[model samples]
Target: MNARQPCRERRQRRYREQCKIDFEIRLLKLSILRGHEKMTRATEDIIDSSRE
Candidate 1:
């Protein structure tokens, strides 16, 4: 085995890990946005019912 192969392998592993983390972050943001929208709808419903 040579030194260059190990370096290249390490870089590839790091790149894969970074990609996974980015994907997870995007999913988390999307879920949070959906939750916020649901909360807003619920609040609106309550306010609307109170006005009746």
Candidate 2:
């Protein structure tokens, strides 16, 4: 099975790299969503304060 070992290792390495990329993308999206929510919430607060 020595011949197949390198192929399997290469596949595993590629999968790990893909997983890392996916994780970073997810983190970036989550942060963006959070920032958007924070921005909207702040705007709402400003509107409410101005009405009083």
Candidate 3:
């Protein structure tokens, strides 16, 4: 029973860590996508201004 308790705890801890890592990765990806969108918009504005 003692051995099982340790194993279960370890598994739960690992699962929590993995979840945290996944969440962080998703947040980073979202930020990167937003940056790309902003850059694209800025480029478009510059081109339009040049044409005018």
Candidate 4:
């Protein structure tokens, strides 16, 4: 109904975009960490098998 409403809506949109970006970043980091752990476990298994 006024100019202030448009400004408020713009700010809300920006905030939502920021949250989306942050969530994606977090997911990327978590997947990277999980992949690293899997690699480490695979290497350890290879070492164990070689020792036998």
Q: Write the per-residue lDDT of candidate 1 for residues 1-52, one digit (tens) a residue.
A: 8879999999999999997976676566556767877645665455446445
- Per-residue C-alpha lDDT of model 3 across residues 24-51, encoded as one tens digit per residue: 7656655676787754666545544643
Query: Under the 3 Å rule for N, CA and C atoms, how many clashes does model 1 have?
Result: 0
**lDDT per residue as tens, model 4, 1-52:** 8979999999999999997976676566556767877546665455446435
Candidate 4: which pairs clash?
A: none
TM-score of 1: 0.64
Name the better of 3 and 4 by lDDT. 4
- C-alpha lDDT score of every prediction, in listed order: 0.70, 0.70, 0.69, 0.70
Give the C-alpha miss distance for residue 16 in model 4, angstroms: 0.1
Error of 1 at 50 (Å): 39
Q: What is the TM-score of each candidate against the true structure?
A: 0.64, 0.68, 0.65, 0.68
Give the Cα-based TM-score of candidate 2 against the true structure: 0.68
**lDDT accuracy of residue 29 in candidate 3:** 57
lDDT of 2 by residue, 1-52 (tens): 6999999999999999997976676566556767877646665455446434
Scanning candidate 1 in windows of ten residues, the lowest lDDT window is: 43-52
